[model samples]
Every structure is written in C-alpha cells, then in structure tokens.
Target: MFKNHPKGLAVLFFTEMWERFGFYTMIAIFVYYLQENFKWDQATVTNIYGIFMAGVYFTPILGGWIADNVLGYGKTIIFGAIVMGIGYAIMAIPTDNSYLVFAGLFVIAIGNGMFKANISVLVGNLYGHSEISLKDAGYNIFYMGINVGAFYAPFAAAGIKSFLMNNFGATLAQGYNAGFGIASIGMIFSLIIFTAFRKYYQQADYQSKKEVKVEKDVVLTKQQEKERIIALLTVFGIVIFFWMAFHQNGAALSLFARDYTHQFVGKFTYLLFDVVSLHAILFAIFGLAALLKKSNSSKIKSFGGIFTLAGLSLLIYKISSLPESGKISPEQFQAFNPMFIVLITPIIINYFSKLNKKGKEPSSPAKIGIGMLITAIAYVIMIIASLGLAPVYTLNGSTSAITVSPFYLIGTYFTLTIAELHLSPMGLSFVSKVAPPKMKGLLMGGWFGATATGNYLAGFVGRFYQEWELWQFFLILIVCAALASLMVVFTLKKLKSATS
Candidate 1:
C-alpha cells in the first residue's frame, strides 16, 4: 500500500503528525481549562471555542497567500510551527490571568492558518494530474498520519495533567499548563523532522507562484477555471454544516462526556479510553489482515507475523497493568474519533480503490453527500441517547445533572469519524485535485475558509446546549447535515462534470 509514492509523502506525513499532536493536545483540554480557570458558563465558553476554531482555519487564507507569494510552503510551515510552539509556551506559563490564555490561542490560530493549508497543497504538488486516484490514496495515507498524532493527544493530555497534579501536587491550572507545554515540545519535534527531511520534498516546495507547475504548466481557460472554482465553492459551502456538527466533539460533546455521560468503566470497556491498548489493537488488526492475505511477498508476510506477535504481546501487557475499574476522563472520550480514523482510513481507501478498479467509484462530491447523510445518522445515536436525559433547561429554569452511558458519545464519535474520513480528507483531496494550479494555495485556503465558517458555527450551535433539550440540539445538527446532503444530491451531477 505504501509502494511507489513520492518520498515527500512520508516527510509531510510525519511533519503533520507531530504538529497535529500539539494542536489536538491543546484542543482536548481547551474548554475544560476555560471552565476551570475562569468559571465561564457554557455559552461563553462555546462562543470562545467557536471563534478560536474559526480563527484557526480562517487565517490559512493569508497563510496560503504568504506561501504562494513570499516565504514559500516550506518556510511558511516552519514559521507556523515556531509560532505555534511559542503560543503553546505562552499558554503553559502556569499563570491565572485569562487574557494570556486568549492571547496564546490567538497566536496558535495565526500559526495554524499558515501551516495547515500549505502542507496539504504540498501533498497535492507531489502528484501529477494523471495520478488522481493515487493522489486520493496518498491523502488517505497522510490523513492517517494526522490521526495517529490525534489518537495519542488526549491520552497525552490526560497523562500529563495527572502526572503533574499527582507527582508534584500542582494545581489544576498548572496541570493544564503542563499539557500545553508538552504541546509546545510537539511543535519543536515537528519543526526538526520537517527541516531535516527538507531534501526529500524540496522539489515540490515552490518559493513563488511563478515556480509552480503541475504537468508542465498546463493552463486552465477562463471558463474552466470559473466552473471548477464554482464547483469547489459549492462543495465547501455545504461541508460547513458538516464541520459545524463534527466539531461539537470539542464543545457540546465534550460537555456531554463530562456532565451528561457516565465516565466509569470496566477493564474491557476501558479499552476505548486507553490509547496504548487502542494502538496495540490497530497494529494487531493490520497484522492479522496482512498475514491472512495470500501475498506472494515473503517479506510482507514475515513483517505481518512479527507485528501480530508484538501487538498481541503489548495488549496482554497492558491488560495486566490496568486497574479493574476506574473513571474515564472527558478529554479521553475525544480520542475515539482519531482512533477510528487511524484504524479505518485504510479500509475506506481500499474500498474506494476497489470501486475505482471496477469503474464504479463515486465522484468525490457524491461521496461527500453520502458522508453528510452519515453525519445525520451519527447524531441519531445522540438523539436516542438523549431521549431519557434531562433537558438542559427546564420549566423551573434549573438544569438537570443526569448522565447516560459513555457508549453513546463513543458510538457518536465513531460514526462521525466515518463521515470525516469521507468528507474532510476528500474535501482536501478535492481542493488539491480540482483547484487550478495558479490558484491552488488561495483556493486551498478557501477550503479552510469554509471550515472557519463551519467551526465558528459549531460554537454558535454549542451555545444552544444550555438553551434547548439535549435531543433538540442534536436534532438541529441532524437537520443541517441532512439538508447539506440533499443539496449535494441535487448538485452532484454538475459538481462531478465540473471537476471531471
């Protein structure tokens, strides 16, 4: 599966892995830190969350322009990483001042905007126009690297906070800062790896738009460029709803895990919350699949056997070491989405690859529509789970303190991860595949621009968490996702033809 790709893919993969580790680490603790540090209500916290996420995505427009026009993708990425590291350091200062927290988030947002879109553009730059199928597959591989970091981030946050608070008798605020400090170190590692591997991806790193060429400067006509941009903008506008719903993982969903969902678990059920165990399971599954395949390559089979044994050994080791029962953390529940991404991305890619071989693969837009429908299905689980739960606000104007099984949030995240694998990576691939070469960076940023809108909307929607019944709030998301899916279904043909 890793065969015959540009060496740059690996370079960018690991670079993104560490950067995302830091970002997700911060995200896993963001709202909790706010609530604990400042005593902000849900509305205020959600609004801030929405704005911060929006800024994180929105700044990419300028970041992409900077890469295209000034510093180049490589320099921009490095600069962004450094800025993010500084921002994380600022957040880790172990102070009680709230403005410093906002200031740190602002800096991180600026840096992420510079970093995110350009690296993705670099990924697309690695492939030729004729390699669209291979390009999509490559993005899936790259996306998995991102999730590997994300999968570890929550655990890292949990472990870091626990260690600081328990071992050093640190306060809660200090523990949160310690996690942010680890996030800062993650950025440093990202910078070192990406800088060291510069040779591998140097060819793709154009210092300016004049140097950019995909397939020997094949230029788009005015009409073609217009149509493609229109199509991409259409898709981007629709997926805003998807992000609005999916990002709830950080806002309403996190709160649900903290307040509305049961956190205690048995040894077996605790597997979901334990990153080490989940990581072992991923290795074992991959190994078992490889070993079962009728591969002619002895090397592949041997590698598979070794991985299988090692993974199972690790799992056994973990099982013996963990407590029989314990309370899981809310931040830990956020890891499920990334864990699913790591485990399932290959399957999704392989499935599409099979369909491609038979000339039956859905167009990117169609798959996106399917993903939106799935997003709706994901929330249906939440709606059901909320059926017996207390209303967020009641007739007496008092909120209930009821909780449900953690499985609801887990299941919701799992289902949403499926939607994300389809919508998000495919969205990035769509932008990379469809955008005109000259406008690649701008339009790529536009994708994030749309995400900025969606993420802001996520926090906006999160505000209603305190206003409506829990089920009603989720139902709003379901309606939005379903409507977005319908829009795609209606526009699928036009979208496909434009991209084609």
Candidate 2:
C-alpha cells in the first residue's frame, strides 16, 4: 500500500496518527469528564462538546490562510502542534473550573485549525497533476493513519484511567486528567516526528521553507474559477449533513453508550487489548522504517511485510478471542469505527482501483453522495435497534437510567464507519484534486468550515437527545443524511461536468 508513493507520505501519516491520538483521546473522555468531574448536566456537556468541536473545525480557515500567505504549511503545522500540546497540557490540570477547561479547548481548537487544512494541502502537493487518480488512494492511506490513532485512543484512555485507579489509587477525575496528560504527550510525539523529519517533505511544496508561488502565476479564466468554486461549494453544502450525522459518535452516541449500552468486558479481553498496544507501537516503527527505507534489498523489504502481517494477525487473534457475552464500555465502542476504517480501507481502495482500470469509477461527488446515503442507512439501523428502548432522559432533562444492548451501538458504528470511508477521505481528495490550484488551501479550509457548520448542527441536534426518544433522534438523523444524499445526487451531473 505504501509502494510508489512519496516517502514524505509516511512522515505525514505517522505524524497525523499521533496527532489524532491526542485529539481523539481527549474527545473520548471529554463528555464523561464534564459529567463525572465537573458534574455538568447532559445539556451542558453536549452543548460544550459541540461548540468545542466546531471551534476545532472552524479555525482551519485561519490556519490555512497563515500557511498560504505567511508561515507556509510546514511552519504552520509545527506551530499548531506546539500550541495544541500546550492546550492539552493545560487540560490535564484536573480542575473543576469550566472556564479553564473551555480555555484549554479553545487553545487546542485554534492550534488544530492552523494545522489541519495545511497538512492536507501538503500531502496533495506531494504528487503531480498526472497522479490525480492516485490522490484518492493517497488520502485514503492518510485517512487510515487518522483512524489508527482514533482506533487506539479510547482504549488508551480506558487503560490509563484503569491503571491510575487500580495501581495509583487515584480518583476517576484524576485518572482522566492523567489521560489528558498522555494525550499531550501524543501531540508532543507528533511534533517531534514532524520536526525531526522536516527535510523529507521539502519537495512536497517545492522547498521546505517556501509557499506555493503559483497563486498569481497560473491564472484561471473567470468561468473556470466560478465553476470550480461552485463544485466545491456544492460538495461542501452536501457534506454538512453528512458530518452532522457522522459526528454523533462524540455526543449523542457517547450518551447512548453511557446510559443505554451494556458495558462489561471481561478482564481477559481488556488484558488482551492492553497487550496489543505494545505490538501497535512495534508495528508502527517497522512500518515507518519500511516506508523510509532507501535500500532495495528484498530481504529488508520482506521484514516490514512480515512485521505488518504479524501485527495484523495478532490483532485479529485477540479480537476473535474476546468472549461474545462480555460487555465493554461505551467509550471502548468508539474504537469500532476506526477499526473498521483500518480493515476496510484497503478493500475500498482496491475496489476503486479496479473501477479506475475499467474506466468505471464513480466520480468523487457521486461517491460522496453514496456515502451520505450509506450514512442514512446506518442511522436507520440504529433506529430499528432502538425500537423498544425508552428515553434515558426526561423531557425536563433528568436522567432515567434505562439501558439497551451493546449491539445497537456496535452495529451502528460498523455501518457508519463504512460511510466514513466513502465520504471523509473522498472529500479530502476531491478538494485536493478539484479545488482551483491557487485557492487550494483556502478551499480546503472551506471544506472544514462546512464541517464546522455541521458540527454546530451536530451539537444542535444533540440537544434534542435530552428531550426525545433514542429512536426519534436517530430518525431525525436519517432524514438529515438522506436529504444530504439527495442534494448530492441532484448536483452529481453538474459537479462531475464541472470537475471533468
């Protein structure tokens, strides 16, 4: 999978993996921390969670601008990582003060904004226009790095918190704080990896320290620019609903896990997962070495392949060994989507590759539309599973404490992960491929801005969870996702025409 791509992709991949580890780690515990530690009500927790995530997505506009016009992509990313690391460090302070928590989140959001869009632009810059077909595959690989971190973050948080409580005799709040501290450490690792390997990505942007000089040189006619903008905006608008449906994992879904799901995994399963972490690190190192290797030795190349297969086989063995009757936590269930991402990415890429060879690959916009429709189906599954479940919260926003089967969430996450595979990475690649060259950074930021809008809507929709039945809430998401999918379908031909 890493073959034929620029070596810099490996650097970006690992860097993003660690960065997402920090982000998802903090996010996995955030809502629970608010309720358990700060004693905030559901409304408050969901509200803050939505707003914080919105800010995180919203700031990329500024970050992208800075990278494009000021510091360039590399510097902006490094700077963003440092600032976010500081924010994570502050969040680790274990305070009851909501102000302090929000302050920390704000800083992290700002830093993420600066880093997110520019790094993607850098990846897109790595290949020539002729490699556009490969761009989607590249982004999918990059997207896998994100899921790899996401896949482990909840586990890490759960493990760390358990360790602190069992061994150190710390309170749950303190353990959560310690978990946040570890998240900070993850960001530090990301920064270190990027800074140490900065030289590898120099050619991605035509020089390590320089910005793209094509902003003014490669001018487009008015009609071409307008059509490009329209196509981007169309995708942006359609994807808003997709994100609104998708990001529920952090808010509404998190609540479902806390209140509805049966969470009681056995000790053996937990232990196996813990053991897998060591292998995760070892595999990452071996993979990195393989990607970075300049040698042509067949034996050396085979070593990386062997390590990859060994790691994956071990992972499958551990998962299959888990007792079916054993329950796990809601947060632990967060791992399922990313795990699916890691498992399914190669299949999706191969499917698309075959389609490309046959000249029958769906256009990026069509794939995104299909993704939205798939997301709607995911919610539909949840609605059906939630049929008999009662509301966990009263109309007046009080807890009722009724729970549902873990399979409800597990099945939902599995379905939605497939949707994410179709939409999220495709959206990134589409932006990289279709956005006007001179405005790539800004337009990429626009994609996130749409996500920001969707995140805000996600929070808005989350507010309904407190007042509505679980099925009703999910039904509403079905409507939203279906509507988005329809919108994309309506524009599919025009979007394809414009991009083609």
Q: Tell me, by TM-score, which candidate is best.
A: 1
Q: Tens digits of per-residue lDDT for model 2 on 375-414?
A: 9999887887677777756524433355566667778888
TM-score of 1: 0.96
Q: What lDDT would each prediction earn against the true structure?
A: 0.88, 0.82
Q: Write candidate 1's Cα lDDT for 293-386 as tens digits.
A: 8953788888888889988999999888889986889899878888899889989988999999999998888889999999999999999999
Clashes of 1: 0
Which runs of model 2 end up more than 4 angstroms from their true locations?
206-219, 265-327, 394-402
Weakest lDDT window of 10 consecutive positions for candidate 2:
208-217
Q: How many residue pairs collide in each prediction?
A: 0, 4
| TM-score of each predicted structure versus truth | 0.96, 0.89
State how far residue 62 of model 2 sits from its true place (Å): 0.8
